[model samples]
Target: MKVAIASDGGNVAQHFGKCQEYAVFDVVDGRSENFSYIPNPGHQPGFLPKYLKGLNVDCIIAGGMGQKALNLFAENNIQPIVGISGEVKQVMEDYINGKLTSGASLCTHPDGQHHDCDGHC
Candidate 1:
């Protein structure tokens, strides 16, 4: 499976749409391999899910995600795992070990406006 983690400066970005890039890993038999980074193309409504899907990403990990994005990912057959935080390497380890699980969305946009949260989300 291919997993992508929304990242900024080697850590998980708070908001997936606003992230600087993605840390992508190809996993086989519960082992992560062939890591790479993909720059964020830009954040437009319903764009990212399609973009990652095009790249054959099977799953996405992020600190937060909007409701619409979550739905879009589902439609694209990409698993969206949100409410994650911390460094990318550590997060990857947890995911490979089956210790990672999603929690509540950290997104604070009730009105659906994309605003900078200064990495606090």
Candidate 2:
């Protein structure tokens, strides 16, 4: 399976749409195989979901994502795991080891302003 973690530098970005890049990791037999970073294509409505789907992304891991993007990902048959933070490598490892859990973080807007994001993830 392939997992995409919305990231900035190496950490999971606070908000999915405003994230700088994506760390795409491939896993097989429940073990991670490899990873690559991809720049954010753009944050226009449903564009990202489609773009990621084209890359055959199976799941998305992020700190937060609004309702629209989550719905689009669902529509595209891509599972989304939100409320994740910390560096991408650790997050991925935790997930692979079945230690990561989704928190209650949800971004209502792309700007990441005027929203309560602190510790929400």
Candidate 3:
């Protein structure tokens, strides 16, 4: 299976849409195959889902994602694993080791600011 992880430098981005790049990792039989980094195409409504789907990503791992983004991913048959934060390599390794477990989102859009966070306060 192929996994796309939302990343910024060495850590998981706080927001999926604002991530600088995506580290695409391919896993076969519980072993990681190869990995590559792709620049974020764009952060438009429903755009990310299409972009990731085009890459044949089976799942998306990220620090946080809003409900709309989650819905879009579901619509495209892409599973999202949110509330994760750490180095891209570690995340991938955890996945390969069957230690990564997905839970609820860890972020909340305070003050109704749904958009334009852009990785900064």
Best by lDDT: 1
Clash pairs detected, candidate 2: none
TM for candidate 1 is 0.90
User: How are the candidates ranked when ordered by TM-score, highest leading?
Assistant: 1, 3, 2
Give the C-alpha lDDT of model 2.
0.83
Question: Residues 1-121, candidate 2, lDDT per residue (tens digit)?
Answer: 8999999999998778778999998988888887899999877667888999999999999988776677899999998898888989999999898898878665645675525433122
lDDT of 1 by residue, 1-121 (tens): 9999999999998889889999999999889999999999988778889999999999999999877788899999999899899999999999999999999877777675656743233
What is residue 58's positional error in candidate 1, in angstroms? 0.7
Screening candidate 3 with a backbone cut-off below 3 angstroms (N, C-alpha, C), the clashing residue pairs are: none
Descending-lDDT candidate ranking:
1, 3, 2
Note the Cα lDDT for every prediction shown.
0.89, 0.83, 0.84
